[model samples]
Target: MRFRKTGAPISFIIPSGNLGNGVAALWTKKMGLPIQQVHFAHNANHAVVDYLNSGDYEPSDTISTLANAMDVGAPSNVERLKALYPDFSLLKRDVAATSVNDASIQNAIRKSEKHWGQIICPHTATAATVREQIGESTNEWVLVSTAHPAKFETIVEPLIGKPVEVPAPLKAILLNPSQSQNISPNLLELLDALSGPKV
Candidate 1:
Protein backbone atom coordinates (compact mmCIF):
# COMPACT_ATOMS: atom_id res chain seq x y z
CA MET A 1 0.00 0.00 0.00
CA ARG A 2 2.85 2.38 0.76
CA PHE A 3 4.17 1.94 -2.78
CA ARG A 4 0.71 2.75 -4.22
CA LYS A 5 1.57 6.43 -4.28
CA THR A 6 4.83 5.73 -6.20
CA GLY A 7 2.71 4.70 -9.19
CA ALA A 8 4.81 1.65 -10.01
CA PRO A 9 3.62 -0.98 -12.49
CA ILE A 10 2.37 -4.05 -10.57
CA SER A 11 2.95 -6.83 -13.10
CA PHE A 12 4.46 -9.92 -11.46
CA ILE A 13 5.83 -13.09 -13.12
CA ILE A 14 6.17 -15.46 -10.17
CA PRO A 15 7.00 -19.17 -10.08
CA SER A 16 4.39 -20.96 -7.99
CA GLY A 17 4.29 -24.58 -6.86
CA ASN A 18 1.13 -23.78 -4.97
CA LEU A 19 -1.09 -20.69 -5.05
CA GLY A 20 0.36 -18.69 -2.16
CA ASN A 21 2.15 -16.25 -4.47
CA GLY A 22 -0.84 -16.36 -6.82
CA VAL A 23 -3.17 -15.31 -3.99
CA ALA A 24 -0.84 -12.42 -3.13
CA ALA A 25 -0.86 -11.25 -6.75
CA LEU A 26 -4.66 -11.37 -6.93
CA TRP A 27 -4.79 -9.47 -3.66
CA THR A 28 -2.84 -6.62 -5.31
CA LYS A 29 -5.43 -6.45 -8.08
CA LYS A 30 -8.25 -6.52 -5.54
CA MET A 31 -6.56 -3.72 -3.57
CA GLY A 32 -6.59 -1.69 -6.82
CA LEU A 33 -3.30 -1.50 -8.76
CA PRO A 34 -2.49 -0.89 -12.39
CA ILE A 35 -1.71 -4.56 -12.63
CA GLN A 36 -1.15 -5.60 -16.22
CA GLN A 37 -1.36 -9.24 -15.22
CA VAL A 38 -0.44 -11.84 -12.60
CA HIS A 39 1.39 -14.55 -14.49
CA PHE A 40 1.91 -17.84 -12.63
CA ALA A 41 4.82 -19.94 -13.88
CA HIS A 42 4.44 -23.42 -12.43
CA ASN A 43 6.69 -26.47 -12.64
CA ALA A 44 5.88 -30.04 -13.76
CA ASN A 45 3.39 -30.23 -10.91
CA HIS A 46 0.78 -27.91 -12.37
CA ALA A 47 -2.40 -27.95 -10.27
CA VAL A 48 -2.40 -24.17 -10.20
CA VAL A 49 -2.52 -23.90 -14.00
CA ASP A 50 -5.28 -26.50 -14.18
CA TYR A 51 -7.30 -24.67 -11.55
CA LEU A 52 -6.95 -21.30 -13.25
CA ASN A 53 -7.81 -22.69 -16.68
CA SER A 54 -10.65 -24.91 -15.61
CA GLY A 55 -12.64 -24.61 -12.38
CA ASP A 56 -11.58 -28.18 -11.54
CA TYR A 57 -9.20 -26.97 -8.80
CA GLU A 58 -8.91 -30.55 -7.54
CA PRO A 59 -5.82 -31.32 -5.44
CA SER A 60 -3.77 -34.37 -6.35
CA ASP A 61 -0.79 -36.40 -5.07
CA THR A 62 2.55 -34.60 -5.26
CA ILE A 63 4.73 -35.34 -8.29
CA SER A 64 8.42 -34.99 -7.46
CA THR A 65 10.48 -32.96 -9.94
CA LEU A 66 13.70 -30.94 -10.24
CA ALA A 67 11.83 -27.91 -8.97
CA ASN A 68 11.32 -29.43 -5.55
CA ALA A 69 9.98 -26.16 -4.20
CA MET A 70 7.09 -26.39 -6.66
CA ASP A 71 6.50 -30.12 -6.15
CA VAL A 72 3.18 -29.63 -4.39
CA GLY A 73 0.18 -31.24 -6.09
CA ALA A 74 -2.40 -30.40 -3.46
CA PRO A 75 -1.72 -26.72 -2.96
CA SER A 76 -2.69 -25.52 0.53
CA ASN A 77 -3.35 -22.00 -0.77
CA VAL A 78 -6.35 -22.87 -2.98
CA GLU A 79 -8.87 -21.67 -0.43
CA ARG A 80 -7.07 -18.36 -0.10
CA LEU A 81 -6.86 -18.02 -3.88
CA LYS A 82 -10.58 -18.74 -4.16
CA ALA A 83 -11.34 -16.23 -1.46
CA LEU A 84 -9.46 -13.54 -3.40
CA TYR A 85 -10.97 -14.46 -6.74
CA PRO A 86 -14.43 -15.63 -5.77
CA ASP A 87 -15.58 -15.10 -9.35
CA PHE A 88 -13.92 -17.68 -11.54
CA SER A 89 -14.52 -15.58 -14.63
CA LEU A 90 -12.68 -12.59 -13.19
CA LEU A 91 -9.85 -14.79 -11.90
CA LYS A 92 -9.06 -16.11 -15.36
CA ARG A 93 -9.04 -12.65 -16.82
CA ASP A 94 -6.52 -11.25 -14.33
CA VAL A 95 -4.32 -14.32 -13.95
CA ALA A 96 -2.26 -16.21 -16.52
CA ALA A 97 -1.16 -19.68 -15.37
CA THR A 98 1.15 -21.97 -17.35
CA SER A 99 2.86 -25.24 -16.47
CA VAL A 100 6.32 -26.43 -17.56
CA ASN A 101 7.33 -30.03 -17.16
CA ASP A 102 10.79 -31.53 -16.44
CA ALA A 103 11.94 -31.36 -20.05
CA SER A 104 10.99 -27.71 -20.38
CA ILE A 105 12.51 -26.84 -17.02
CA GLN A 106 15.77 -28.46 -18.11
CA ASN A 107 15.75 -26.49 -21.34
CA ALA A 108 15.01 -23.29 -19.46
CA ILE A 109 17.91 -23.81 -17.06
CA ARG A 110 20.29 -24.73 -19.88
CA LYS A 111 19.23 -21.81 -22.06
CA SER A 112 19.46 -19.42 -19.14
CA GLU A 113 23.07 -20.37 -18.46
CA LYS A 114 24.17 -20.63 -22.12
CA HIS A 115 22.41 -17.51 -23.31
CA TRP A 116 21.94 -15.24 -20.27
CA GLY A 117 24.99 -16.48 -18.32
CA GLN A 118 22.79 -16.97 -15.28
CA ILE A 119 22.80 -20.05 -13.04
CA ILE A 120 19.15 -19.82 -12.01
CA CYS A 121 17.41 -22.34 -9.79
CA PRO A 122 14.65 -24.57 -11.23
CA HIS A 123 11.82 -22.47 -9.79
CA THR A 124 13.20 -19.29 -11.41
CA ALA A 125 13.58 -21.20 -14.70
CA THR A 126 9.77 -21.64 -14.82
CA ALA A 127 9.25 -17.90 -14.49
CA ALA A 128 11.81 -17.24 -17.25
CA THR A 129 9.85 -19.48 -19.66
CA VAL A 130 6.68 -17.44 -19.20
CA ARG A 131 8.55 -14.17 -19.41
CA GLU A 132 9.85 -15.16 -22.84
CA GLN A 133 6.35 -16.14 -23.99
CA ILE A 134 5.07 -12.74 -22.91
CA GLY A 135 7.97 -11.14 -24.82
CA GLU A 136 9.54 -7.77 -24.15
CA SER A 137 6.93 -5.25 -23.04
CA THR A 138 6.53 -1.91 -21.32
CA ASN A 139 5.17 -3.66 -18.24
CA GLU A 140 7.80 -4.34 -15.57
CA TRP A 141 8.24 -8.01 -14.67
CA VAL A 142 9.48 -9.09 -11.25
CA LEU A 143 10.90 -12.62 -11.44
CA VAL A 144 11.01 -14.18 -7.99
CA SER A 145 14.24 -16.16 -7.44
CA THR A 146 13.18 -18.48 -4.67
CA ALA A 147 16.49 -20.31 -4.20
CA HIS A 148 20.07 -20.35 -5.40
CA PRO A 149 21.04 -22.88 -8.06
CA ALA A 150 24.04 -23.90 -5.97
CA LYS A 151 21.67 -25.64 -3.56
CA PHE A 152 20.46 -27.97 -6.35
CA GLU A 153 23.86 -28.89 -7.72
CA THR A 154 22.93 -32.48 -8.42
CA ILE A 155 20.21 -31.40 -10.83
CA VAL A 156 21.75 -28.21 -12.20
CA GLU A 157 25.45 -29.11 -12.51
CA PRO A 158 24.81 -32.19 -14.65
CA LEU A 159 22.50 -30.25 -16.96
CA ILE A 160 24.52 -27.07 -17.23
CA GLY A 161 27.75 -29.12 -17.35
CA LYS A 162 29.34 -26.73 -14.84
CA PRO A 163 29.82 -26.75 -11.13
CA VAL A 164 27.74 -24.16 -9.29
CA GLU A 165 30.03 -22.65 -6.70
CA VAL A 166 28.45 -22.57 -3.28
CA PRO A 167 27.89 -19.02 -2.13
CA ALA A 168 30.28 -17.92 0.64
CA PRO A 169 27.41 -17.06 2.95
CA LEU A 170 25.92 -20.53 2.62
CA LYS A 171 29.34 -22.11 3.29
CA ALA A 172 29.76 -20.01 6.43
CA ILE A 173 26.35 -21.08 7.72
CA LEU A 174 27.22 -24.72 7.15
CA LEU A 175 30.56 -24.23 8.92
CA ASN A 176 28.97 -22.44 11.88
CA PRO A 177 29.11 -24.11 15.30
CA SER A 178 26.39 -26.75 15.39
CA GLN A 179 25.10 -29.10 18.13
CA SER A 180 22.88 -32.18 18.13
CA GLN A 181 22.11 -35.03 20.49
CA ASN A 182 20.96 -38.58 19.75
CA ILE A 183 17.69 -39.30 21.46
CA SER A 184 14.86 -41.82 21.43
CA PRO A 185 11.72 -41.07 19.41
CA ASN A 186 9.87 -39.49 22.29
CA LEU A 187 8.82 -36.06 23.58
CA LEU A 188 11.04 -36.56 26.65
CA GLU A 189 14.15 -36.61 24.50
CA LEU A 190 13.06 -33.36 22.81
CA LEU A 191 12.31 -31.78 26.20
CA ASP A 192 15.72 -32.86 27.56
CA ALA A 193 17.51 -31.32 24.55
CA LEU A 194 15.62 -28.04 25.05
CA SER A 195 16.74 -27.96 28.72
CA GLY A 196 20.46 -27.65 27.63
CA PRO A 197 23.54 -29.87 28.04
CA LYS A 198 23.96 -32.48 30.81
CA VAL A 199 26.20 -31.20 33.60
Candidate 2:
Protein backbone atom coordinates (compact mmCIF):
# COMPACT_ATOMS: atom_id res chain seq x y z
CA MET A 1 0.00 0.00 0.00
CA ARG A 2 2.73 2.44 0.91
CA PHE A 3 4.59 1.61 -2.29
CA ARG A 4 1.55 2.34 -4.45
CA LYS A 5 0.72 5.49 -2.47
CA THR A 6 4.23 6.70 -3.17
CA GLY A 7 3.44 6.41 -6.91
CA ALA A 8 5.39 3.21 -7.42
CA PRO A 9 3.98 0.50 -9.63
CA ILE A 10 3.79 -2.68 -7.59
CA SER A 11 3.37 -6.11 -9.14
CA PHE A 12 2.94 -9.20 -6.98
CA ILE A 13 3.69 -12.57 -8.56
CA ILE A 14 2.45 -15.31 -6.28
CA PRO A 15 2.24 -19.10 -6.28
CA SER A 16 -1.11 -20.77 -6.80
CA GLY A 17 -2.44 -21.34 -3.29
CA ASN A 18 -4.56 -19.85 -0.52
CA LEU A 19 -1.55 -18.22 1.09
CA GLY A 20 -0.86 -15.96 -1.87
CA ASN A 21 -4.52 -15.06 -2.24
CA GLY A 22 -4.93 -13.72 1.30
CA VAL A 23 -2.51 -10.83 0.93
CA ALA A 24 -3.15 -10.16 -2.75
CA ALA A 25 -6.61 -8.80 -1.91
CA LEU A 26 -5.31 -6.34 0.66
CA TRP A 27 -2.73 -5.00 -1.77
CA THR A 28 -5.13 -4.57 -4.67
CA LYS A 29 -8.00 -3.10 -2.67
CA LYS A 30 -5.93 -0.87 -0.45
CA MET A 31 -3.09 0.01 -2.83
CA GLY A 32 -4.63 -0.23 -6.31
CA LEU A 33 -1.50 -1.82 -7.76
CA PRO A 34 -1.55 -4.58 -10.32
CA ILE A 35 -1.22 -8.19 -9.19
CA GLN A 36 -0.06 -11.14 -11.25
CA GLN A 37 -0.79 -14.56 -9.76
CA VAL A 38 1.19 -17.49 -11.11
CA HIS A 39 0.56 -21.20 -10.58
CA PHE A 40 3.42 -23.68 -10.32
CA ALA A 41 3.11 -26.99 -12.15
CA HIS A 42 4.72 -29.12 -9.46
CA ASN A 43 4.15 -29.19 -5.73
CA ALA A 44 7.12 -28.74 -3.37
CA ASN A 45 8.63 -32.23 -3.73
CA HIS A 46 8.38 -32.89 -7.45
CA ALA A 47 9.19 -29.31 -8.48
CA VAL A 48 12.62 -30.54 -9.51
CA VAL A 49 11.29 -33.39 -11.58
CA ASP A 50 8.66 -31.20 -13.24
CA TYR A 51 11.24 -28.57 -14.08
CA LEU A 52 13.57 -31.18 -15.57
CA ASN A 53 10.84 -32.66 -17.77
CA SER A 54 9.09 -29.38 -18.61
CA GLY A 55 10.09 -29.31 -22.27
CA ASP A 56 8.41 -32.50 -23.50
CA TYR A 57 5.83 -33.17 -20.79
CA GLU A 58 2.67 -31.24 -20.15
CA PRO A 59 1.74 -29.97 -16.67
CA SER A 60 0.04 -32.64 -14.60
CA ASP A 61 -3.65 -32.19 -13.86
CA THR A 62 -3.11 -33.77 -10.48
CA ILE A 63 -1.80 -31.34 -7.89
CA SER A 64 1.04 -33.29 -6.36
CA THR A 65 4.55 -32.08 -5.74
CA LEU A 66 7.09 -31.78 -2.96
CA ALA A 67 7.42 -28.08 -2.26
CA ASN A 68 5.06 -28.34 0.74
CA ALA A 69 4.95 -24.61 1.27
CA MET A 70 3.05 -24.24 -2.00
CA ASP A 71 1.01 -27.39 -2.11
CA VAL A 72 -2.39 -25.80 -2.62
CA GLY A 73 -4.90 -27.96 -4.44
CA ALA A 74 -7.52 -25.21 -4.67
CA PRO A 75 -6.44 -21.63 -4.33
CA SER A 76 -9.16 -19.71 -2.43
CA ASN A 77 -8.04 -16.36 -3.76
CA VAL A 78 -9.96 -16.65 -7.03
CA GLU A 79 -13.13 -14.95 -5.82
CA ARG A 80 -11.26 -12.03 -4.33
CA LEU A 81 -9.24 -11.80 -7.50
CA LYS A 82 -12.39 -11.63 -9.59
CA ALA A 83 -13.89 -9.01 -7.30
CA LEU A 84 -10.69 -6.98 -7.45
CA TYR A 85 -10.53 -7.08 -11.22
CA PRO A 86 -14.07 -6.79 -12.55
CA ASP A 87 -13.15 -6.45 -16.18
CA PHE A 88 -11.84 -9.80 -17.30
CA SER A 89 -10.02 -8.33 -20.28
CA LEU A 90 -8.33 -5.64 -18.20
CA LEU A 91 -7.40 -8.23 -15.63
CA LYS A 92 -5.91 -10.39 -18.34
CA ARG A 93 -4.00 -7.40 -19.70
CA ASP A 94 -2.54 -6.21 -16.39
CA VAL A 95 -2.69 -9.44 -14.39
CA ALA A 96 -1.15 -12.64 -15.69
CA ALA A 97 -1.45 -16.24 -14.50
CA THR A 98 1.05 -18.70 -15.90
CA SER A 99 1.80 -22.32 -14.99
CA VAL A 100 5.44 -23.38 -14.85
CA ASN A 101 6.23 -27.01 -14.11
CA ASP A 102 9.06 -28.26 -11.92
CA ALA A 103 11.40 -28.84 -14.84
CA SER A 104 11.33 -25.15 -15.75
CA ILE A 105 12.03 -24.13 -12.16
CA GLN A 106 15.06 -26.45 -11.90
CA ASN A 107 16.30 -25.22 -15.23
CA ALA A 108 15.99 -21.67 -14.00
CA ILE A 109 17.95 -22.49 -10.83
CA ARG A 110 20.74 -24.10 -12.84
CA LYS A 111 20.75 -21.29 -15.39
CA SER A 112 20.83 -18.60 -12.72
CA GLU A 113 23.73 -20.33 -11.02
CA LYS A 114 25.67 -20.93 -14.24
CA HIS A 115 24.89 -17.54 -15.78
CA TRP A 116 24.54 -15.21 -12.82
CA GLY A 117 26.20 -17.33 -10.13
CA GLN A 118 23.31 -16.60 -7.78
CA ILE A 119 21.66 -19.26 -5.65
CA ILE A 120 17.90 -18.71 -5.44
CA CYS A 121 15.28 -20.68 -3.56
CA PRO A 122 12.47 -22.62 -5.22
CA HIS A 123 10.05 -19.66 -4.98
CA THR A 124 12.49 -17.46 -6.86
CA ALA A 125 13.03 -20.21 -9.37
CA THR A 126 9.27 -20.20 -10.03
CA ALA A 127 9.36 -16.42 -10.48
CA ALA A 128 12.24 -16.70 -12.94
CA THR A 129 10.34 -19.24 -15.00
CA VAL A 130 7.32 -16.92 -15.20
CA ARG A 131 9.51 -13.95 -16.12
CA GLU A 132 11.08 -15.91 -18.94
CA GLN A 133 7.69 -17.02 -20.23
CA ILE A 134 6.40 -13.43 -20.14
CA GLY A 135 9.28 -12.42 -22.42
CA GLU A 136 11.31 -9.24 -22.31
CA SER A 137 9.10 -6.21 -22.16
CA THR A 138 9.64 -2.52 -21.47
CA ASN A 139 7.99 -2.96 -18.08
CA GLU A 140 10.50 -3.14 -15.23
CA TRP A 141 9.61 -6.51 -13.76
CA VAL A 142 10.80 -7.18 -10.22
CA LEU A 143 10.60 -10.71 -8.87
CA VAL A 144 10.28 -11.04 -5.12
CA SER A 145 12.61 -13.84 -3.97
CA THR A 146 10.55 -15.18 -1.08
CA ALA A 147 13.22 -17.09 0.80
CA HIS A 148 16.96 -17.71 1.08
CA PRO A 149 18.28 -20.78 -0.72
CA ALA A 150 19.58 -22.24 2.53
CA LYS A 151 15.99 -22.62 3.72
CA PHE A 152 15.82 -25.67 1.46
CA GLU A 153 19.47 -26.67 1.38
CA THR A 154 18.60 -30.34 1.33
CA ILE A 155 16.80 -29.94 -2.00
CA VAL A 156 18.94 -27.20 -3.54
CA GLU A 157 22.51 -28.26 -2.72
CA PRO A 158 22.59 -31.58 -4.55
CA LEU A 159 21.00 -30.03 -7.63
CA ILE A 160 23.44 -27.11 -7.76
CA GLY A 161 26.22 -29.65 -7.10
CA LYS A 162 27.51 -27.38 -4.32
CA PRO A 163 26.59 -26.16 -0.89
CA VAL A 164 24.38 -23.09 -0.85
CA GLU A 165 25.62 -20.19 1.25
CA VAL A 166 23.45 -18.60 3.87
CA PRO A 167 22.98 -14.88 3.77
CA ALA A 168 24.24 -13.02 6.86
CA PRO A 169 20.74 -11.99 7.99
CA LEU A 170 19.39 -15.57 7.81
CA LYS A 171 22.46 -17.06 9.53
CA ALA A 172 21.09 -15.87 12.86
CA ILE A 173 17.94 -17.95 12.40
CA LEU A 174 20.00 -20.94 11.43
CA LEU A 175 22.03 -20.59 14.60
CA ASN A 176 19.05 -20.69 16.97
CA PRO A 177 15.48 -19.47 17.10
CA SER A 178 13.82 -18.96 20.47
CA GLN A 179 10.58 -20.72 19.68
CA SER A 180 8.40 -21.89 16.82
CA GLN A 181 4.63 -22.18 16.72
CA ASN A 182 2.75 -25.09 15.18
CA ILE A 183 -0.72 -23.92 14.14
CA SER A 184 -3.54 -25.67 12.37
CA PRO A 185 -3.90 -24.81 8.69
CA ASN A 186 -7.25 -23.21 9.24
CA LEU A 187 -8.19 -19.97 7.49
CA LEU A 188 -10.77 -19.06 10.09
CA GLU A 189 -8.21 -19.23 12.88
CA LEU A 190 -5.86 -17.05 10.87
CA LEU A 191 -8.56 -14.53 10.05
CA ASP A 192 -9.65 -14.40 13.68
CA ALA A 193 -6.18 -13.46 14.72
CA LEU A 194 -5.88 -10.85 12.01
CA SER A 195 -9.27 -9.37 12.90
CA GLY A 196 -8.86 -9.45 16.63
CA PRO A 197 -9.36 -6.27 18.61
CA LYS A 198 -6.48 -3.84 18.38
CA VAL A 199 -4.28 -3.46 21.39
Candidate 3:
Protein backbone atom coordinates (compact mmCIF):
# COMPACT_ATOMS: atom_id res chain seq x y z
CA MET A 1 0.00 0.00 0.00
CA ARG A 2 2.79 2.42 0.90
CA PHE A 3 4.63 1.36 -2.26
CA ARG A 4 1.59 2.27 -4.38
CA LYS A 5 1.20 5.61 -2.62
CA THR A 6 4.86 6.58 -2.78
CA GLY A 7 5.47 5.28 -6.32
CA ALA A 8 9.09 4.57 -5.39
CA PRO A 9 11.11 1.89 -3.67
CA ILE A 10 10.70 2.33 0.10
CA SER A 11 12.62 0.88 3.03
CA PHE A 12 10.82 -0.27 6.18
CA ILE A 13 12.18 0.04 9.69
CA ILE A 14 9.96 -2.43 11.56
CA PRO A 15 9.92 -2.98 15.34
CA SER A 16 10.32 -6.75 15.61
CA GLY A 17 10.60 -9.40 18.30
CA ASN A 18 9.68 -12.76 16.73
CA LEU A 19 10.82 -11.41 13.33
CA GLY A 20 7.39 -12.24 11.89
CA ASN A 21 6.84 -8.70 10.65
CA GLY A 22 10.37 -8.44 9.29
CA VAL A 23 9.97 -11.75 7.44
CA ALA A 24 6.70 -10.49 5.95
CA ALA A 25 8.53 -7.47 4.59
CA LEU A 26 11.16 -9.76 3.09
CA TRP A 27 8.41 -11.79 1.41
CA THR A 28 7.01 -8.57 0.00
CA LYS A 29 10.41 -7.80 -1.49
CA LYS A 30 10.60 -11.34 -2.88
CA MET A 31 7.25 -10.77 -4.58
CA GLY A 32 8.91 -7.91 -6.51
CA LEU A 33 7.60 -4.90 -4.59
CA PRO A 34 9.70 -1.74 -4.82
CA ILE A 35 11.26 -2.30 -1.41
CA GLN A 36 14.88 -1.26 -1.10
CA GLN A 37 15.68 -2.35 2.44
CA VAL A 38 13.87 -4.18 5.23
CA HIS A 39 15.45 -2.89 8.40
CA PHE A 40 14.60 -4.33 11.83
CA ALA A 41 14.34 -2.02 14.85
CA HIS A 42 14.80 -4.01 18.03
CA ASN A 43 14.35 -2.89 21.61
CA ALA A 44 16.64 -3.84 24.54
CA ASN A 45 16.03 -7.47 23.61
CA HIS A 46 18.51 -7.53 20.73
CA ALA A 47 19.07 -11.16 19.78
CA VAL A 48 18.24 -10.42 16.14
CA VAL A 49 20.66 -7.46 15.89
CA ASP A 50 23.47 -9.43 17.51
CA TYR A 51 22.87 -12.41 15.22
CA LEU A 52 22.67 -10.30 12.07
CA ASN A 53 25.77 -8.26 12.83
CA SER A 54 27.97 -11.15 13.94
CA GLY A 55 26.55 -13.93 11.75
CA ASP A 56 26.36 -16.01 14.90
CA TYR A 57 22.93 -17.15 16.11
CA GLU A 58 23.17 -16.97 19.88
CA PRO A 59 19.87 -16.47 21.75
CA SER A 60 20.06 -15.37 25.36
CA ASP A 61 17.40 -14.83 28.03
CA THR A 62 14.58 -12.45 27.23
CA ILE A 63 15.12 -8.92 28.53
CA SER A 64 12.05 -6.93 29.48
CA THR A 65 11.75 -3.36 28.17
CA LEU A 66 9.34 -0.45 27.61
CA ALA A 67 8.62 -2.05 24.27
CA ASN A 68 7.11 -5.08 26.00
CA ALA A 69 5.66 -6.38 22.76
CA MET A 70 9.18 -6.79 21.33
CA ASP A 71 10.88 -8.36 24.37
CA VAL A 72 11.93 -11.49 22.55
CA GLY A 73 15.38 -13.01 23.02
CA ALA A 74 14.68 -15.99 20.79
CA PRO A 75 13.12 -14.90 17.54
CA SER A 76 11.11 -17.82 16.10
CA ASN A 77 11.35 -16.60 12.50
CA VAL A 78 15.17 -16.43 12.35
CA GLU A 79 15.38 -20.03 11.19
CA ARG A 80 12.96 -19.12 8.40
CA LEU A 81 15.15 -16.13 7.57
CA LYS A 82 18.23 -18.39 7.48
CA ALA A 83 16.39 -20.85 5.24
CA LEU A 84 15.33 -18.06 2.90
CA TYR A 85 18.79 -16.46 2.73
CA PRO A 86 21.24 -19.27 3.46
CA ASP A 87 24.31 -17.14 2.83
CA PHE A 88 25.06 -14.85 5.78
CA SER A 89 26.36 -12.09 3.47
CA LEU A 90 23.18 -12.17 1.35
CA LEU A 91 21.03 -12.09 4.49
CA LYS A 92 22.94 -9.05 5.72
CA ARG A 93 22.48 -7.30 2.37
CA ASP A 94 18.74 -8.13 2.27
CA VAL A 95 18.16 -6.83 5.80
CA ALA A 96 19.49 -4.23 8.20
CA ALA A 97 19.05 -4.41 11.99
CA THR A 98 19.80 -2.32 15.08
CA SER A 99 18.89 -2.20 18.76
CA VAL A 100 17.60 0.74 20.81
CA ASN A 101 17.51 0.64 24.59
CA ASP A 102 14.80 1.81 27.01
CA ALA A 103 16.42 5.28 27.22
CA SER A 104 16.25 5.67 23.44
CA ILE A 105 12.63 4.46 23.40
CA GLN A 106 11.70 7.09 26.01
CA ASN A 107 13.60 9.77 24.10
CA ALA A 108 11.89 8.81 20.86
CA ILE A 109 8.46 9.08 22.50
CA ARG A 110 9.21 12.47 24.02
CA LYS A 111 10.79 13.80 20.81
CA SER A 112 7.93 12.64 18.63
CA GLU A 113 5.35 14.33 20.83
CA LYS A 114 7.40 17.48 21.27
CA HIS A 115 8.54 17.91 17.68
CA TRP A 116 5.94 16.27 15.47
CA GLY A 117 2.92 16.22 17.82
CA GLN A 118 2.75 12.47 17.23
CA ILE A 119 2.09 10.28 20.27
CA ILE A 120 3.69 6.92 19.45
CA CYS A 121 3.73 3.72 21.50
CA PRO A 122 7.01 2.33 22.86
CA HIS A 123 7.05 -0.38 20.17
CA THR A 124 6.74 2.28 17.47
CA ALA A 125 9.28 4.44 19.33
CA THR A 126 11.92 1.69 18.88
CA ALA A 127 11.50 1.99 15.10
CA ALA A 128 11.44 5.78 15.40
CA THR A 129 14.74 5.67 17.29
CA VAL A 130 16.28 3.57 14.52
CA ARG A 131 15.00 5.99 11.90
CA GLU A 132 16.73 8.80 13.81
CA GLN A 133 19.91 6.74 13.81
CA ILE A 134 19.58 6.16 10.05
CA GLY A 135 19.12 9.95 9.47
CA GLU A 136 17.94 11.49 6.19
CA SER A 137 18.16 9.35 3.06
CA THR A 138 17.08 9.50 -0.61
CA ASN A 139 15.42 6.10 -0.10
CA GLU A 140 12.00 6.59 1.52
CA TRP A 141 11.96 5.10 5.00
CA VAL A 142 8.73 3.93 6.59
CA LEU A 143 8.80 3.46 10.35
CA VAL A 144 6.11 0.91 11.11
CA SER A 145 3.74 1.93 13.93
CA THR A 146 2.84 -1.40 15.55
CA ALA A 147 0.26 -0.24 18.07
CA HIS A 148 -1.71 2.80 19.22
CA PRO A 149 -0.06 5.06 21.83
CA ALA A 150 -3.13 4.88 24.10
CA LYS A 151 -2.68 1.09 24.43
CA PHE A 152 0.54 1.71 26.40
CA GLU A 153 -0.60 4.51 28.71
CA THR A 154 1.51 3.31 31.64
CA ILE A 155 4.76 3.78 29.69
CA VAL A 156 3.88 6.48 27.16
CA GLU A 157 1.82 8.89 29.32
CA PRO A 158 4.72 9.57 31.71
CA LEU A 159 7.19 10.04 28.87
CA ILE A 160 5.04 12.38 26.75
CA GLY A 161 3.76 14.23 29.88
CA LYS A 162 0.16 13.81 28.79
CA PRO A 163 -2.50 11.17 28.45
CA VAL A 164 -2.77 9.66 24.99
CA GLU A 165 -6.29 9.91 23.67
CA VAL A 166 -7.67 6.46 22.90
CA PRO A 167 -9.31 6.17 19.53
CA ALA A 168 -13.10 5.70 19.58
CA PRO A 169 -12.91 2.08 18.37
CA LEU A 170 -10.19 1.20 20.88
CA LYS A 171 -12.08 3.01 23.65
CA ALA A 172 -15.16 0.98 22.86
CA ILE A 173 -13.12 -2.23 22.97
CA LEU A 174 -11.54 -1.23 26.27
CA LEU A 175 -14.97 -0.70 27.82
CA ASN A 176 -15.59 -4.43 27.40
CA PRO A 177 -14.26 -6.77 30.06
CA SER A 178 -10.87 -8.35 29.36
CA GLN A 179 -10.71 -12.08 28.61
CA SER A 180 -6.95 -12.34 29.01
CA GLN A 181 -5.27 -14.71 31.46
CA ASN A 182 -1.75 -14.81 32.93
CA ILE A 183 0.08 -18.12 33.02
CA SER A 184 3.63 -19.39 33.05
CA PRO A 185 5.38 -20.60 29.88
CA ASN A 186 5.15 -24.22 31.00
CA LEU A 187 2.99 -26.42 28.81
CA LEU A 188 1.38 -28.05 31.87
CA GLU A 189 0.32 -24.66 33.15
CA LEU A 190 -1.19 -23.83 29.79
CA LEU A 191 -3.02 -27.17 29.69
CA ASP A 192 -4.30 -26.66 33.25
CA ALA A 193 -5.51 -23.16 32.40
CA LEU A 194 -7.24 -24.43 29.28
CA SER A 195 -8.80 -27.31 31.25
CA GLY A 196 -10.51 -24.79 33.60
CA PRO A 197 -11.41 -25.27 37.34
CA LYS A 198 -11.35 -28.72 38.96
CA VAL A 199 -14.64 -30.25 40.13
Best by TM-score: 3
* Stretch of 10 with least lDDT, candidate 1: 1-10
User: TM-score of every model?
Assistant: 0.83, 0.63, 0.86
Query: Model 1: residues >4 Å from true position, as ranges?
Result: 1-8, 32-34, 136-138, 177-179, 182-199
Candidate lDDT (C-alpha), each: 0.84, 0.58, 0.91
lDDT string for model 3 (1-199, tens) is 8767868898899999999999998988889978889999999888888988788999989999999989999999999999888888888887999999999999999999999999999999999999988887887888899999888999999988888898999889989997878998999999999999899
Task: Point out the higher-scoring one by TM-score: 1 or 3.
Answer: 3
Candidate 3 residues lying further than 4 Å off, grouped into runs, are 1-7, 179-199
Q: What is the per-residue lDDT of model 2 for residues 2-106, given as tens digits with 9 covering 90 to 100?
A: 545665444555554344543453355357455333233233433223322342212233465434466654444545555665665654455554556677767
Which prediction has more favorable lDDT, 1 or 2? Answer: 1
Q: How far is candidate 2 from the true structure (C-alpha RMSD, Å)?
A: 8.4
Q: What is the lDDT of residue 199 in candidate 1?
A: 93
If both were scored by TM-score, which would come out higher, candidate 1 or candidate 2?
Answer: 1
lDDT of 1 by residue, 22-50 (tens): 67877777787668678888887778788
Question: lDDT of candidate 3?
Answer: 0.91
Report RMSD (Å) for each prediction in the order shown.
3.0, 8.4, 3.9
